[model samples]
Target: MAFRKTLLAAALALSLGVSAGPAQAEVKIGFLATLSGSGAALGQDMVDGFNLALEERGGKLGGQDIVLLKEDDQLKPDVGVQAVQKFLEKDKVDLVAGVTFSNVMMAIAKPLADAGMTFVGSNAGPAPLAGAQCNPGFFFAAWQNDGQAEVLGQFATDRKYEDVYLITPNYQSGRDQVKGFTRFYKGRISGEVYTQLGQQDYSAELLALQAANPSAVWVFLPGGMGVNFVKQYKQFGLMGKIPLLAASTVDGSTLPALGETALGVYAGTFWGPDFQNPVSQAFVAAFEKKYNRIPSQYAAQSYDSALLIDSALQKTGGKIDDKQAFRDALRAADYASVRGAYKFNVNGFPIENFYAFEVAKDAQGRVSLKTIAQPLTDHADAYAGNCKY
Candidate 1:
């Protein structure tokens, strides 16, 4: 009877959150993204990238099994906040990653910082976190909100576009992008329009743009919004009349739908299908084999995020509870990135390159983004100057 009682007590202790041994320990990660609605494609690609990395590692990171919980933010701040609250307060997850949209990230950045949880952001680099509000726990594995846009703006300046019109979704990222574009483009402002976020119908905006007839039109729409806007712009027969220069408006995420219609649309990016590096080649081949679609900047950034986590875990021997050690390990960024060159700046955002890409048909006659011009090399975010640590 005594032996049976002791065994029962041990079982009770194990059930009450006592780990029997190190073998039983696992890393709990909560990955939240806008997995539905207008931003679904971007979030889906990010999830795929992270999953592919885990699959390659046999579903383990840093020698410990990962207990990953994926949640959909639905592109709404309130919904994202509720989901993050559960991850931080209830589940007590060790890490947080994969936020596809900026609005959701803006909503939860503060809470994650106050709780002292690390966010290995795969996407969505909001400007505030890269500046005065920067925190040690928030590491963005993607470009700053304005970095790519600044490249596009510089491209426009190089081309000597005299009058340019800007259109973007009305949100934090949208504002940041426009600010980046105008930061370099020494051009006369023809017009500026901010559309409702996640808006599907862009007829009014397209018509207004045609009426303006500026020397060039710059936009920052992504995902479904890009698809709809490009289709409408073509339908309204304004394709060749005014040049379209964009950032995130014409890329792998929307190219499947836009097809030949998106051909010749110029956009700015950091990675694409044509990257020749061995790491990039392997990642693209594996992603294509697994997903049967071309990997976009979305996938590349998220893939780097997973790789960064794996490398950091290797340094810490899979231990994540020691906040400073894990933070230091991540800061080291000892990993082979899918993008050619990658490292975190003082602000925790990436110091990388951005380039110009054009929508064109490859040898196989399928529409793809092709590298065109070198825009910004070893580019750091404009906000990094304000960050201390």
Candidate 2:
């Protein structure tokens, strides 16, 4: 009887211990991006960068096990909204990250804000979110929608590129790109053309640009759109006729496919592999060693996003529920980033220096970008003045 009672007690104790074993509470992070279609490359890069950071940090954020729920918005605003809704209402994600397009970010911003969920944008810095509609919950890990374009515009002005033609997609973000370019570009405006969003064909636009014969062309086509534009631009023989000065999109993500065609393109960006900082150097080396390719500004931005989250969590002692405290910690910018120096703007966007880069073949004969100049010094986006939060 005694032996049976002891065995029963042992079994009960084992069951209780199993039941009480460290209550695993999962912190779900929803990553919504254009996983298919034209923007898939950018999304894939972001995922790669994000996962790299997570792996480096041992798959934990804020001292908790992270459960990442990935959804492909396919560059559609409606799909983005639906994905965000599902994440917030059903999956109960602690945060939403990795939006690639401004339109998609705009669509889900207010809803995510209302839900009191943290929206950490790995890319897609729309103007509205930086300005009047800015919310405490929305933090941009990338530059503001127009910040890099504004840098490009200033670079063109300094170079005396008169009669510049501007081309961008006909979307809210595209419009903002043109506006940003014009804001600092004091030279004569040749013409402004807005193409359909994600339009694969740019032949008509090229013809128009050729007829205008602008001294320089400024374009803001990212992801697949950039791929299509560069290919079409080359086919039309516009590469030799006019110089192209564009945002980072021109070569950062498209260079692998663009190959020799991306040569001689000037791009302005906030981060690049050529940055001479120790942190950036180590990051570039490690990233290349692991991925067997150079990392783009997109990857750098996403990597920073993950590190920022980790830093904030560490600051708050890994408390995810203290949203206000978490935001404060993130705003403090306590972590070291590969970008060298970056701090949050009053509107929660990054306040970082912007550099102008030229696409050129490296010693290894691989196409890469080289930084020429820092166009913006301690720059702040124009929209930040309007933000109350």
Candidate 3:
């Protein structure tokens, strides 16, 4: 009777698959961004794009369920640090991603590195992180802070612009922008102005720029500052009179907000709405359909970050616990990038194409970025040589 009972129990367990143990550990990723304040739109775009990638994969990465923890830093460095602490201590996330501003990124990067956490940058690759402070555990799905401006600067030099005025907020990224431009642009700079970070009014700056009598103006203001600067530029009747060149000042999300004021502005970026690759087309289509608007470069980079993470996880067979193995998988970067043919440099920053973009009205009368030229072909950041790793 005992033997018979044992055989019956074994059959029941086999039929029900009760011998299978608990399910796999959920892969948790914490996304910290400036989800509130002036950079809110940019941060929200990134979050949307990241989530969209996960949704397309049925909320699974490498056959493991994914749990995403999102927190708002309010564009404050101290607040970003606090969020990092929570993500590390409370959420117990396997990886951390997203930092829309360089100031916040700089504040939180060391803490994450100290904890031996894997960080995939969606935006805001500060110069220090890309150079002397490069960490093996860090990977960037976005360009370094200076790359786009470097392209613009090279274009300015090629165009033979004699006197140019430069403006950026006083911050890590701003300094990087100036460094990048001065590296490529041989023109005499009329002024190198550093405004307060997140400053609303540019009237005083604009008046000063007018006095400089620059043949062209270059700006790296992003988010709300871009909107304010561009709008004021138009209001001050300086739009068509002086050529406005920029790096993140006028982009997909900001262009819509700036409307007709942003028209004819020349900018440089790694991704455009009309990028022709198959993967790029698919991402742009899905993003527009889901959000009822075109995705910005910020969104495209975040989307790529999620896909890169998925590819790496799959390569490691979902064994993210093995940090070095996971890092190696990510460094391989085997997935298709929406930016097309992207690779990581020695410093873990992207080496990719940078294009010249002109803001124009689409057939549907929406302000958008049109790829006019490829200024920087297969460009890499300047800080890679300084990286010890």
Candidate 4:
């Protein structure tokens, strides 16, 4: 009888302990981007921005211990898919963030969504994803890929540039940029060229552009491709003659390497150093002090992305297991964003202001973007009409 009583008591104690112990409350987040190769610069900037936000939040997001798994996709679709799978299956990350390339974003969107993971896009904004194939699980923290380009196009038209040459990488995002630019620009398009995506050599295309002799050149090349193109355009002595107008690439990410070559160029974007918002100013100051360089728009977007996730987690009391509640919290746009007042469109993309910016040197001998004009005031992207949910 004594032995029987002892065994029953031990079993009861074990059961009680298992039942009373607190459940694990940690949240795992996966950050996927081109952390290596040509696109590394943009990826590093994004990582820096996200880290800064995490630090500001005391290294906790949504009231839980946030674990970030960083992966390098190398700008390839297959690699990106594999990275997302690993994050979803192997690491069991609850959310995935920071995909910079549109191609890569499309490659991983469905699978990540199917896994019931929240995928927040910090940069890439492919039109198709925004339209018919839009998923509720996918949220774009950055502006639509073409919204900034539209600002540049309208600015060019306003300035009365009769003839313009447009060039972009021959990819979905690149093609969408040209389309977006043309939507607002009413001038004669002397040339519209779509070059091979990730092609380093722009000499042949530049020569062709020179032959066309357009009044101005508008381009959309991000990361190392932008750096190489700007350097080569300068070497060909086309900078002064053609009057380069760009969208978020020339001065945002490539300025550090291009130096004086990037000066006097015109770009259109949603964020800049002179945005005159308290959140933006503080972010820029903090980033510059930490990295010894001006944070690009890519960095700004990523910072916002991290903060949004953290804010959503806070709303849920740091519980990431409740997918529906988390998604609702994200849709509420409850976080303080660095981009002033940012809200999500019906399609779960950002509805923000677009600014025309000029690359200029300040009194402190630093290169930064100055606001030249505001094209879109509280604008929603064009694809919002297609979203049923």
Candidate 5:
């Protein structure tokens, strides 16, 4: 009779949306990130940064041994969906982590939520996730799809860049960027251009840009696309002749490839390699030491994701089976984020400061990003109010 009661209790716990806790002091997490083709550097940084955080604790989180199952999304929505399904049906991970693009997140979010899975995303927060379509257990550690774009808009306004043109890959995130920029930009838009997702050559686009002859151009190109665009822009003699602004175009991941050509390019972000704070300083130093390269915003966010999981597990006494308990601990957000100031909004997005960065040569004559100005302080997203859950 006692044995029967034990089984019944376990069954009851499972039915009530609570985790029964792992049989052993072990937690399995499925980590998926884009790791091939065009934007692979961004994906590699995300994986390496998250691994560094785990290694710091001797491959443990909250006193429990962590089993990380990694997958490469290949930067495709269909591929990402398949990887996520494997995590659900085969690995049975306690939580899912690391998505490089918003499209992949959109493909995987619903299925994971439907399976009562907790997705601790480190990058790519689509607007709907912060608004009407929020999932109960989905948490994005990075800023929303529009967060940096909104900052770019404010930066443009502060600089008084009139007749600013826009260019981005034609995707949901691309559209979101334009929308967010227009929200705060008080200037006339010279034009808007959308290109293919992984377009390598921007020669044609650059020709059109020259014809437009806008006072300034703001772009959302990232990874190889950013490198190609900047190189072509320079070849077209538009680098210094026209003011080029962006959010993720010339970042740590692509800066090396761009070299001096990417110099003087301004971008907006919530954190950078030069972000000053003890926690951030340590992370940046440790990351550079291990990887021998400056960590990108993607890396910073993924590192935070690892910290978030560790902190939440600690709060739960190393128990991740309790769904609400784990989520609540995550909501508490007890870890010292590398970004210095970070808090999850009601929709599980962040409200933080944003800054404009210029790629400059430091005293050592090494290329690095220098924070020029703060565009937005304590900024929250516009769609959070509409989030139902």
Candidate 6:
């Protein structure tokens, strides 16, 4: 009778959030990305990179068991909202990570802010969030949408290209890309064109560029869109005629399909496979060995995102309940980044170096991003001044 009474008492205690068992620390993480359709490779690479960091840490982050709940948003805003709702209501994740598209990020950003959940973005940084709508809970592992473009634009300007043409998809990121490029580029823009997102055909755009006869063309297409655009650009004989400068339009994920067409393509990026930093070298070697493919900037950023979380968790001694405390920890940015030294700004964005990378054959004859020069140094986003947080 005493044993029955004790069991009942324990059950009541458990139901009231008191446990007789020892408290085990666990951190739940929700990862939302576009892991379907033609752009699947990008999201898949990001996830793989994130997992590799966990593998190195023995599947634990910051001495806490990490429960990663991954969901595919299918590149849809509504679907992304649904996934974020599930993460907040059902999964009760401590952190939300991995948004590969700006639209999707926009769809879920407000909810994450409202819930005060820490958001570590692996990809897709929209401008509004970085500026006026900035949330203290958000930290971008990747640069703001305009960051890469701004670097590439500076590269074009330095190259002394007098007349340059710009092309991007007609979306939030696309508009942001144009804004970023023109911010640093002082040269005349011969033409500015916007195509449909996930557009497969670029013949019309090519014709416009040909007619414009610009000295250089800066394209902001990504994923399969980049692949198609590069192939068509080569076919149109503009590959050699007009210099091609892009922001992540040609990368490791798309290089295999691009093959010879991607050769000599200049890009502006934050990290490269051949970067000489110890942590970066380690991550690059491990990622290539495990995936049997070169990791893209997307993958690099995702990996950094994981490392960032782990660093914060360690700082807080595996306790994530205190929002401001955890936010302060993340702001420290003390971890060794694959992109070398980086520090968080007042707006929770990174102030880091941006470099120009050219597609070149490595010792193994594999296509890789070879660091050319640092175009932008310790750069901070333009919209940071407007951030309330």
In candidate 1, which residue pairs clash? none
Tens-digit lDDT track for model 6 on 1-389? 99999999899988998877777789999999889976788899899999999999998999998999999999889999999999999998989999998988888988888887899899998999989999888999889999999999999989999989999989888899899999999999999999988999999999989999999999998899999999999999988789999887888879988877788889998888889999999998999899899899889999999999999999999999998888899999989999988999877789999999988898899887889999999999999999985
Tens-digit lDDT track of model 3 for 136-166: 9999999999988898998898889998999
Q: Candidate 5 vs. truth: CA RMSD?
A: 6.5
Candidate 5 to truth, TM: 0.93
Query: What's model 2's lDDT at 130?
Result: 90
What local distance difference test score does each model get? 0.88, 0.86, 0.91, 0.85, 0.89, 0.91
Give per-residue CA lDDT, model 4, range 1-389, as digits (tens).
Answer: 99999888778878787533466577788999888877888888888888888888777787677788999999999999999999988998888999988899888888976777788888899888788878888888888888988988889989899999998999878988998999989899999889887779998999999899998999998888888888888899997778888875766578888888888789998888777778888998999898888889889999989888888887888877788899888988887777788788878888888888888886688777878889878877788889775
Residues 168-265, candidate 2: write the lDDT tens digits.
88887898888889999999999999988878998889999989999999999888888888888889998867998877456557898888897888
TM-score of each: 0.93, 0.93, 0.95, 0.92, 0.93, 0.94
lDDT of 3: 0.91
Select the stronger candidate by lDDT from 1 and 4: 1
Clashing pairs in 3: none
RMSD in order of candidates: 4.8, 3.7, 2.3, 4.9, 6.5, 4.8
Q: Which ten contiguous residues of candidate 2 have the minimum total lDDT?
A: 17-26
| Candidate 5 deviant stretches above 4 angstroms | 1-24
lDDT score for residue 76 of model 4: 94
Per-residue lDDT of 1-389 in model 1, one digit per residue for the tens?
A: 99999898889878998855545478999999888998999999899989998998999987779989999999999999999999998998999998988899999987898888999998898888899889989999888899878999999999999999999999999999999999989998899899999898988888888888889999999899999998988898878778888787787788998999988899897888888899888988899899988888898888889989998999998899898999899998888887776778888888888888888987678888888888888899888889876
Ten residues in sequence with the least summed lDDT for candidate 5: 17-26
- Return the candidate ranking by lDDT, descending: 3, 6, 5, 1, 2, 4
